[model samples]
Target: MTKDTTILLIGHGSRGREGNKETINFAAQWRERHPEWRIEVCFIEHAEVLLDEGLDRAARNAKKVLAIPFILNAAGHVKMELPHALAEARQRHPEVEFLVTRHLGMGREILAVLQGQLDQQIKAMSVPDPMTTGVILLGRGSSDAGANGELAKMARWIFEDNDHELVDLAFTGVTWPRLETVVQRQVKLGMMQIAIVPVYLFTGVLIERIKEQVARLQNQYPQVSFALGTHFGFDKGIFDLLDSKVNGDIEEGGMLECDGCKYREAAEEEHLHDHSHTAIGGGGCAHGHDHQHEHGHSHAHGCSHKHD
Candidate 1:
């Protein structure tokens, strides 16, 4: 096994083109910070550059590779699809080492992002009602009962753990007290205005559908007011947070270079001759090709990320 290090940032495919855009953009930024590292972006489906292909591309002569899922929940894809794929990839490439980092689950920093959106939405409203202001913690619903249950538990932690002596909280889907139901109860309890903090990293069908749903609920209950919160975008702090996970996994794996954690500039001349990026499964696909209409590139074997 060559000592080469490779990282694969995997995300579930979305019909909404923007979701792909964000995942790709995030990959681009991460690459910029660690230009020396071999990085690539791939999807589960819908997108042409799927996970298997991405893994195949990044496995060339590289001794260690890290496959990190850029998912918010650990329920469905993370627990099932992701691991199975990684296992298969490892079996096919017995010489190369491949592993997965944890999904970006409920964390304090993520809550900080949510709270930030909520605060921004509330500020935009500028209403006089402080106690009457409420928050609807919106999340992409999952089929896994445990994951759904965890959201409620997360909301409880957020509302109570944060020490915010203001506003009421509720979950929008699955578990008990769905979005509309939460809205109804919160309204009955004297909170009239509400803001939705979508527990997603990017905006797309989920965001649009959520806004439409909230709008309908507002119209049905003329007594209540509502507005959608913000989406996560171009935050420098997020890079640092993700960086921590990368580093942690590397240290845990006991590699000479914690392939997951720190970012380093690739010695261009040194890696140019390395097969680590292309030595995995099959003949290389023509990656970095103009794949999408907007981005116009596949960003294969190249997972460069930047601040812009």
Candidate 2:
């Protein structure tokens, strides 16, 4: 890639204007924050600016364009579609160098953002001790077991490091231990207060769904109080994470290390569950994307276990 590189941030477009606006604004903030680098934003679908248009804009003065998928995980779009789009762009502009950066996956910065949100929510509860509080991490579940497994692992890390009594992992859709089951399990475990932290980027339908589910749970268990934490938005920490990526500080080689992936053959034989996949990718905005990777397991094993 050339030094005169324009960072093209690709967002999964949304039907709602607010979603689109937020996505565009994130890129705008990045540009203002890092004035030295030339940045442009575009969407895969349901947006004013498309990928091709963003590439054209980048080609004006930039010798190379670094197309970064501003997504949370390495879902379908990152694995296949984005690459396909970049491949097409390369064909169009043969002279201009086109490179694809790694998607926003498991990282220290992301963990920091989650931890910050969790701590803020826990403080608001005014509970006598965090040891009595149970945490329910809600994820946008994917058919790809690998994606679901990643979220489960993060939940374990959170539980182990924090003083919370128990940390449970659950998904809003497509996988096991749905929101209700996880919440009920915590209640059964005699947790007085449960903190529901949504592992999402940006406000969207899934976040709303989580709120609705929390409300239902509150109604069901009036005695047990529930607190729904904020989603990961265009925070400064997130910007710092992206900045590191743009500066070539992120290592992408081990981005998808599926050593014991159930979907793939491993040295240790582990029994895997049969999961039904809908399509390559679907939905726009938030955690909606293609789940083309090898999904490992339901992540049910990690739930309800206290990590000391």
Candidate 3:
């Protein structure tokens, strides 16, 4: 909340130009909304400014730095990479206090955004009968089983209150039930209409790939009407979620689920040997932190996380 406090907004950097621009634009808008704190945007990989450079710039003139990962799920980047970077930064800039906030995990705000997208896609259909139509909530799949499970959980959440006959989950790559496979299965199950909802934050190569796949599927199944839903781009609900994270309004119970995380399991395995690195959801920092480790400074708030 203070001018001296810097917000190091870390994004999962992309190789595509538009993807990186989306993050930069979002950070600019966030800065405009909350002018009190200094905001610095950086990426985890494949970007001009990486995390290390971003940390240096953020810690240079700020008394306290709040590092927030602008990623949806707690994958390897959130669980491993970001924490390690922060830990190294803390050691280098011991004069500055550092606070790490939770990633944008599944919450009401995220659900609301997805619900809105689904509504829009359904409404655009010529025959929006939920009984005959099927919806596929597609995600950028991860090797992390827990992160993939989160997508499945989200699909179930979307189906619970809705009238949709079938709500299924699929991944772009690196996992089972791929988009094309799901589309074929749904068609065989007598789905006259299918909507593919991409659970992405920005337009990138993956988005384009999804679009291309939909086009191919449309040609393959001319009788089945397929509608592609939009990604969560600069939505108000997402902004609210990020604000809650920064302000510490979200309860710890709603933080990232670490029970099934492979990284957490590995860290626990190492802990037997007195290793210092702790799980993200645990009391200690993501990298290495003893139970009693303290920054000696205070701040207002506060991912193997990646995106396509």
Candidate 4:
């Protein structure tokens, strides 16, 4: 609602040119929709406009800058690097106010996007029967086991909601059962068709990798049909989520169901430290305390994300 505010949508930059261009295109679309506020795009890495440059651009004439982390979740970038970067940027430009919106956490909206994409793939196919079909929810893997397990949770939810006979999870890199192996095994298990639904925000090198694997598998076994689902691009729901965050509707907190999270074991191994040792910044915790551990303090508002 503020007229002098600028919206800085920060993306996880991709090495691929197409990925960067796609982000620019999405920014253009957003600008068209909301002509009042000045909208800009920047990447954390592998792009022309880096975070500092973006801050410089956004603070040119604006009194307030609303920086939305256009990320899937609170991965390493969101948790540690992003906050550190913002802190520096704020120091550099003391005149301009910088506010970071929450990362894109898991919810019914994201599930709706996935389901919509899968539905489109199913409607396009001749045999859309769930009894003989399978779905693979592909994710960009992470070293954090809890983050990796989020994909497993999504797979379970998709299987429960949809009629898919089998819903499996696989990762493209870092950690996991590789996507190629899972697809091949599913074909061998007598799945007549399989849909690879990418749990990604946009097209990157990983999207290309998914396409390559799907093509290789399709050629290897022509009997088992393969279809590629869409990624979460500039969907209306994603826009709504970002808008909600900018409006301060969503609070900071952990988004994943972490009761059985492997990260919990890692977190529990350490003992809490004294609040007197709170670091320079807010310490990445909502509780206002700090500990000098390998993994930083937890925030109730942070979300989990895979390696970008």
TM-score of each model, paired residue for residue: 0.73, 0.78, 0.82, 0.79
Off by over 4 Å in 3: 249-308
User: Please, what are the lDDT tens digits per residue for candidate 1 over residues 1-308?
Assistant: 12387877888878899888988998898889977767878998768789888888778778878877777765545544555567668788999888667766677767677667766877777853656777777776754544555566667765774433334444445445567777777778777777777777776776787778888988888886777875684566567667776676443453212122111122122221111111124422221111122333233553431211
Model 4, clash count? 6
lDDT of each: 0.63, 0.69, 0.77, 0.71
**By summed lDDT, which 10 consecutive residues of candidate 1 come out lowest?**
270-279
Q: Could you give me the TM-score of model 4 versus the true structure?
A: 0.79
User: Of the candidates shown, which would achieve the greatest lDDT relative to the real structure?
Assistant: 3
The residue-by-residue lDDT of candidate 2 on 1-308, one tens digit each, is 24588888888777768777888778888778877788888887788888778778877777787777787765544444455456567788888877666677766777788888888887788854776688988887776655677788788889878888889998888778898998888888888889888987777767777788889889999998788986676878888877777778433432222211222222112322222222223311112223233443333432121111
In model 4, state the lDDT of residue 171. 89
RMSD in angstroms between candidate 1 and the native structure over all alpha carbons: 14.8
**After best superposition, candidate 3 residue 31: deviation in angstroms?**
1.7
Evaluation by TM-score, superior candidate among 2 and 4: 4
Clashes of each: 18, 7, 10, 6
